[model samples]
Target chain A: MKIHNFNAGPSVLPKEVVKKSAQSIINFNGSGLSLLEISHRSIDFLEIIEKATFLIKRIMNLNDDYAILFLQGGATLQFSMVPYNLMNQEASYLDTGFWAHNAIKEAKKFGKVKVLFSGKNKNYTYISTNYHIPCDMDYFHCTSNNTIVGTQMKIFPRTSIPIVCDMSSDIFSRKLDFCQFGLIYASAQKNVSSAGMTIVIVKKNILGTIRKNIPSYMDYKIHIQNNSILNTPNVFSIYTSMLTLKWIENQGGLSFLEKNNQKKAKLLYDEIDQNNLFENKIHQENRSNMNVTFFLKEKNLEKEFNKMWKKENIVGLDGHRYLGGYRASIYNALPLESVQFLIEIMKEFERKFS
Target chain B: MKIHNFNAGPSVLPKEVVKKSAQSIINFNGSGLSLLEISHRSIDFLEIIEKATFLIKRIMNLNDDYAILFLQGGATLQFSMVPYNLMNQEASYLDTGFWAHNAIKEAKKFGKVKVLFSGKNKNYTYISTNYHIPCDMDYFHCTSNNTIVGTQMKIFPRTSIPIVCDMSSDIFSRKLDFCQFGLIYASAQKNVSSAGMTIVIVKKNILGTIRKNIPSYMDYKIHIQNNSILNTPNVFSIYTSMLTLKWIENQGGLSFLEKNNQKKAKLLYDEIDQNNLFENKIHQENRSNMNVTFFLKEKNLEKEFNKMWKKENIVGLDGHRYLGGYRASIYNALPLESVQFLIEIMKEFERKFS
Candidate 1:
């Protein structure tokens, strides 16, 4: 039975990508060596990373000004690395949700950090778009999507200072203007690849401006110079990412993915709004297309709602630990039929209850 | 046609480990989700990491004083992290080979570094155990095995100060007393599993003494607090490592592996000694049982030697780019039969030449 997986991260991968990844584990491109066993510097792996870099840049519509890197340490590492490399004295951050809060905390450890705007006061249901950017700061940072609250920034705040974004949850899900951001990083669990690797797209000229002598592993300039092969990378994750990218390209790139994602979100959100039993706290314009969070109106119906979903073969619909509600994360790999299936279950439960 | 793999790191894995890992990639223990597609916080992955942590400590004969962590960003990350978290004023390092040199370079960026001993002047043909370690230094660091030069420390140099070892290449190839080192870190590609994940074993008390506000990702204390679940780790690598660890245990643990590894090393070393066509560089006492590096007596036979090995379905024998020769890394999973096959080919080639 194919479970309709809606995991937020390390989440659903395309069936074809999973099949090919499994095959590569046994034998990578018929090299008589498992992809897991080969040297990262081998011709096969070098080509794999090269193609992955190309695909990421092409998908993002980025140019030579940006250097594409596949790194380990995930986005959590980037929390500190961003400040360690970019912040000279002070930086401004938009505190959106859980991950963005972490980015702010880590930045403060290195130097002065100014929280220009915060959604915490309102439970992070809405995006803070009308934020005042401090021109004196080295860079402005924000989380593109709040995974826990299912709120996303549809329009980025323009700032004279270099802009940084932690697009961990919604990086390749939509058309992103590459020119606006100085640095963009995303952990490859949600929409890109698997867990453990982070894709960093940075404008090359933005690095080396900080006077602090940064550690090589965390330094963007060093990684760019080495082409992200500073050490033996997470080869499996990068290769898996390559397969995912290939899958996305085959599905007709960002435009098609964006449309599909929006359609899925509309179907689920519309059901939640019309049905009295369910409630979506997020504002309609701010609701994430990738992660759609909802709760039961009566609160007592939570258990029965969960059982119904389980019976329908739904997985990862349980909300985050901090938030006790249901969240359906419909990433690029999630098919429209799965969303439709979830909608049908919701409507059936509503009808039965009424 | 399974080629005999001998790559130094990211090398051969046990047949069972590979099979089980491939299966998990498709469906993790019948969870209806690929291992690559599950959240790190999921119970399934949590259990996998717990088992892996337990097995590593148990295999090493470590007590609760030690903390075992599975992290992303390979041993290369450890180069800077060690100094950032451990070194306060000054540190000492043994100059062994390529990786050790890199470690020293990274450490200097944080504090004063002193080279306690250097094997470089002699082309790393011997391990230096006679050198004096400075007790006043913050910590003394060394590489347990020189992968490129095929030299292993038969006995570690005792130091009163904290002792850290980069055991990337020869971690589980033999049995050893684990009490001597304050910290032991190894990239999984060598003996543990695949690339992209690093295993760190540290004495819990050694942390918080430095007083530096270490980055969360680099801080051993933080990782220990989080049980190495501080961020999204390389899930695929850790799971695969757990499978390999189980395979190691089923093969009768480290004692059996030590005996098997020694026997394989002796078989090949004896051939190199007896056969006048090839010459081994390192002294007998310092010779590594994990990686056996050698060269042709005439150097002109290199092309023919490579071709002969290729015809026999032998792989990863090519030396490091910096060093031009051959390195056969017979990690724990490599069978005695493979070593015997390699010896047979060496003899046949010798006979043909004679």
Candidate 2:
């Protein structure tokens, strides 16, 4: 049975990326050594670092001004690190969803964090409209996409303050403006390869601004100086991400990926809107092009529907424990056919129950 | 040509471990998703965590009194964390080499670190003697293996106080008296799998004694409370380590691994000792069975010998930049055949250059 994966964040990956990564693990470049066992400082492994870094720049249109680092500890760590590094005085944060709320909580420990706006009043079902970027704040922080609620900031708010983004869920799904942000970090799981490596793209000028005594691993300046080999990196995960970047490039870069993502989201969203038995909760204008969340006409049918989907090998459809319905995360690498098949399944369910 | 990997830390791994790990990354146990891309909270992944934790206890012969944790940020992070969690007052340390020194430095940031003894008088060429552990110290800290200097503590020092060991290089390479040590940690690159995961074996009772407001990530109590899933862990590395653990079990457990390691080390050490062309600098009694550091008889011939070894596909023989010469790290995955091959190459070099 060909199962369709719709896992949110540590989600689906391209088949070629998985195959290439697997081969490298067994025998990397005919060296008769597992990638898992090669030193990160070795010339062979350093080449991987170089190639991965180069591909990241080429794909994202980043320049020499920005340094790419592969660090451990997920985006959750970065939420604190971003504030620890950049927030000496105050930082303006837009609270959109659960992740943003968590980021704000971490930032508060470092210094004063000015809440520019929040969507919590609507139960985080929408992105906030009001914006008040604090002039004295060190940086304005925001999550590019809200994974839990299926809402994305289609266009970023204009701000003069140095911008730092926690793009953990929506990093490579679309082309990002690299020059605008001082620092951008993404936990590599969604749209990237796996769960282990966190990619930090930082502007070289913004390295040593933190006032407090920063730990070597947490400090961007130390990492830039050491070339991300300050310690033994997550080697296998970084290598797999390199393979994924290659796959993304082969699929015609972000421009092509954006179109594919739009198509996948459209197929599922259209089905949800047209069917009387289904309803997508998010406002249509701000709906995520990656994750499409919908619910059955009656809450009673939810458990049975989830069970049927599980039997059919349609995995990860049961929504987050907090959301409590259904969500199909159609990230990059989820083929259009998979989404179509899911829509067909929905139609079959509607016919049987509607 | 098959290469002999002698890279310190991320050195070599069994072919079977790599193959199995690669398979899991592509589709873990018929889950139809890459192990690299799965939520840590997923039932499949939870089983992976449970099994890995269980197997560590089985392999180490640990009793129920110890709690095992898989953490991020490497041994360097643990250098600071150990003290942050345990060093409420004074801590005793044996300054053996670079790693021990780094640990002392981090510990100094929190409280007074009493240097019980140091091999710095001999440039850390040997393990310390004439140790005096302070009774008032909270705990005694020591690094079991020094990767850079190629020296190891043959036996752990007996102590009334709690003992903490950074067993990064020689962990699982030999039999460990788990009951003697209060806590033992190893960054997974050396003898386990790849980098990114740090395995901490902590005695259950010693956790709550520390009186400090440690950050959530740095706090051992929080990790113990959350079952090491305080946040999303390095899932792929943990999964790979599980594969390595299973491989270790299959090869007749730790006893078999100890014997195999001893045999491999003896082969290389014999060649170094018998041949006039090579000389191991460390004190023989304190010499590491893992990293065998040696230099050529003629300084000029070192370059020629390195080139010759490279031609034989022996990679990562070049020692740490801080400690010049060559280092052959014969970790568990390094077959005895590779050591014999290296010996043959050395003899050939001796015939031509000696």
Candidate 3:
């Protein structure tokens, strides 16, 4: 039976990409050598990284002003790197979820990080409406979508300050004005590729502005100068991302993926709101299409609900450790049928108990 | 036709490791899910990482005083991280090769870096045998094997200060007194895994000595606390390393592999010394078993030699761009038959041209 995978990060990937990646691992381009064994400087791999960088830029409609780099370490590394390279004296960040809070924490180490707004008061059930961005700050940082709590920032704050967004969870799944941000980074595990590499798209002008001497690996300017080959990169992850980004391009780019994601999210969320046994706690407008958080109305029936999903082969539905409900992450690779199957389980539980 | 592969670092892996790794990528232990899709926090990955850490410590005969960690950004990142975490007022470094010079360069940014010795006068053809490591320095750093010019430090200096070794190119290829070092790091691409992940073995007591505020990712103490999962690690690279390490264990551990490596090195080095067309420039005692760098005695025969190797379906024969000739990297995974094949080509070229 096909497992209805909902696990966030290192999560579902396109089947075609997985198959092709496996084939490459065994015999890369019929070279009689596994991709794992080839040199990154080899023409085969050089073409891969080049195409990966090219695909992402074209897929996102990014212009020549941007530099696309695939670097090791996840988005967490970028938390420190962003501030190390760009933060001069002060920066602004929104505390939306667990990861966003971490970005704020790491940034504070380099300089002052002003929390523009936080959703912590209501158990992170909504995104803040009113916020102020100090223009004097070096940059404004925000999480585009909160994976842990299933909240997203739909309307970005309009300001002259360079907006640095952490789009780890919802990048490439929706259409947005990417030009509005100075820097954007996403851990490939979420929606891009595997779990080893992070993709960064940065405006060239925003780099090298900090006075502090940045470590070479964390310095964006150095990486851009080296064309992202400053060191040995995560070859598998970058190749996987290239395959995935090509898949997106084939499916008509972000606009089509965004529409498919919406369809899946609506099917799951509608069942959560209408079913008597379930409750969708996150505010309707701020709810994330990438991750849908729902809970059992009656706490005592948790065991029954769990049994139903297990029998239906639903996986990764358990919420984050910090949040103990259920979260169905409907990422770009998750098919609509999986969401439909999950709704069937939710409906059956409602009928049996309600 | 079987290719006699000899590319250094990201060169070749055990065939079994590549096969199993590729299978896991597709189905992942019959879980009906690709390994690329499973969460890093899942039980499967957690077990893989734990076993990997255990195997390395046992293989190296490390006591509880050592901490094993798998990190990203390769050994180049370690160039900066070592100084960031351990350097106090000053440290000593030996400049042996292209990479060693880079390590010294990065360390200078953190504190005063004293050059204990250098091989620059000989075109990095030999390791400096005499070096005074001051006890006052926080640590003495050296490269165990220089991949660029095929020089290996057969003997290390005795010192009271912490000894840090960058064993990137020749880790686990020979038996050594691993307990003598304060820290040992190897980028997995060379002798361990695919790429992106670097293996770090550090003595526990040496940490927390630097009073500087280290970045979380760069700090060894933080990675130790997190059990090498400080962030989403290079899952593919880690998994591949685990398989290769397991292969090493099944082949009777490092002692057996060390003897086999010596046999292969002796066979090839003897042929190089006897062959009239080729030259081995590195000092005899400093010649590396892992990477054998050779040059054409008669420069005009370079075209014939290149043609001969290409005809045999051999790849990755070119040496580092800085040193133009050939570098045959005979890692543990490379069969002795490949060496024999390469020797056959050299003998044929000499018979034809000389």
What lDDT does model 1 reach?
0.89
- Selected candidate, larger lDDT, 2 vs 3: 3
Q: What proportion of true contacts does candidate 2 retain?
A: 0.64
Q: Give the poorly placed runs of model 3, Cα more than 4 Å off.
A: none
DockQ of all models, two decimals each? 0.78, 0.64, 0.77
Give candidate 1 regions above 4 Å deviation: none
Quality of candidate 2's docking, in CAPRI categories? Answer: medium
TM-score for each of the candidates: 0.98, 0.96, 0.98
Candidate ordering by TM-score (highest first): 3, 1, 2
* Candidate 3 per-residue lDDT over residues B222-266, each given as its tens digit: 999999887788887888889999999999999999999989998
Ten contiguous residues with the weakest lDDT in model 1 chain B: B126-135
Docking class of 3: medium
For A160-263, candidate 3 gives per-residue lDDT tens digits of 98999999999999889899999999989979888878999999998876788777888899899998888889888888899999999998899999999989
Model 3 chain B: ten consecutive residues of lowest lDDT:
B1-10
Residue clash pairs of candidate 1: B10-B189
Model 2 Cα displacement at A98 (Å)? 1.8
Q: How far is B5's C-alpha from truth in model 1 (Å)? A: 0.7
Cα lDDT of model 1 by residue, A43-123, tens digit: 888999999999988888889999999999988899999999888899999988988998898888899998988889898
lDDT of 2: 0.85
**Model 1: per-residue Cα lDDT at residue A120:** 91
